[model samples]
Target: MASGQVKSAAFVLLLLNLLLYFIVTVMAVWAVNHAIVRSRKTASVLTIPARIFPIYFPVGNMATGFLVIFSLIAGIVGMATSATGYLNVTDGKIQNLHAAAASSLVTLFLTFLAMGLACKEINIGWIDANLRTLEVLVIFVSATQLFCAGAIHARVSEVATILNIYGSGRV
Candidate 1:
């Protein structure tokens, strides 16, 4: 019920969220490798939906991986700053918490969007090739969205802090 307790709870949740994010990322990478191996053996592309896209193009894997790493870093930084601010309960820290949380959330959102677009592209390629890439891409996109949702949930407390600061008639 106390603010300290709330902050402690938030910290625990954030750590758990981070753990899940890491797990999902690892799984996605594994899935991509598996799909590539299967495709190389069978020379087939897997199709899912017209909305989904294949990521067979050059540099696509690097781009997706970069987005994932960036999102992960942002999430970690945001959660760390938020936990510190909550634990310290000092003035002016709230703004830092807010900005960090917002930036992290935005990064996560962008990452999710990129994953989705990649999935869409992969799905399109599936129509022509029998590659299992579409399934892997879909799983990766789902994981990204789930991770982003967790980050957004973690940001809620920080966002409230920002709103309260502005509402209190203090700059």
Candidate 2:
């Protein structure tokens, strides 16, 4: 495929990723609103593991959302530079790909942790059915978005490296 088409594909994927993260963030906020904040204090010592680490789920979800936003922004900036013919294998533009990949990796880790915590909570019946469903959706979508971000980063990096080889590092 031509370089222009590749950048456009990345642009579309980035937009889809942005929308997915936005949805996940909204769902997470809704779940947080419904979840109990302090009622776990009076629970018996027999409480499940979910009771022991309730904050991680919500906080992780929020952090994933934030990281995804950064990745999305970085993706857009990278695309803009590529479109303007400013991309280089050994220049500041390469940093954008690295930043996006790093953000996505962190987001993926946090979302996975959140999903595990959500499962614990679900098993113990600590979460409402409706909110549990939404939270699960958020976790799942965020995971997919993070995966795409990683893929885009890899594609851009490979392309940049190949272009460098062809250009003999002169550009």
Candidate 3:
């Protein structure tokens, strides 16, 4: 594939990842806050359980959403700097790329955990279904981004040399 095409794909994937995570985060916050508000309306006795698994699901979703967003931002920045090869492959950018990859891994794990909790609690509610779909898409896109970023970063010079290109902008 052409370098430009790779970079373009990276940009688009990153954008989609960002948008999906943003939506998921907003929905999660809304769901969580709604529950909290409803809980506050009740005057029931405070039955504090030492191990309440229900709360962790929403919290995990919220955390995953935030991490996914961070990954998306890093991916977008790295891809956009493709034209400036050194800038794209520098320590900061590499860190960003790795951060994104790590975030994706964490998100994938958290997503499955949340889904399992949902299955146990709600038997696949509408919100859970949507979140699951979004989570899968993000996982796929982020994984692709990580693979491409690693290859591009590792052999950027080789690619340019093989193609008989000049200058750092060869990427």
Query: Which is superior by lDDT, 2 or 3?
Result: 2
lDDT of 1 by residue, 1-171 (tens): 445554455455445545544554454455456546654433334345411344432223424443334434444443454344334333325455465456545545655554555565464443322123423433453454455445434455654665687764222
Write down the lDDT that model 2 would get: 0.49
Instruction: Please identify which of the two predictions, 1 or 3, would achieve the higher lDDT against the true structure.
Output: 1
Model 1 Cα displacement at 84 (Å)?
10
Which scores better on TM-score, 2 or 3?
2
* Candidate 2: pairs in clash: none
User: Which regions in candidate 2 have their CA more than 4 angstroms from the true location?
Assistant: 1-9, 35-92, 168-171
TM-scores for candidates 1 onward, in order: 0.43, 0.54, 0.45
Error of 1 at 44 (Å): 5.4
Compare the candidates by lDDT and give the number of the best one: 2
Off by over 4 Å in 1: 44-92, 107-171
Measured on C-alpha atoms, candidate 3 has an lDDT of 0.44
TM-score of 1: 0.43
> lDDT tens digits, residues 35-129, model 3?
45654433143445613424423323424434334434433443333323333333324445445444444544454454444343334333455
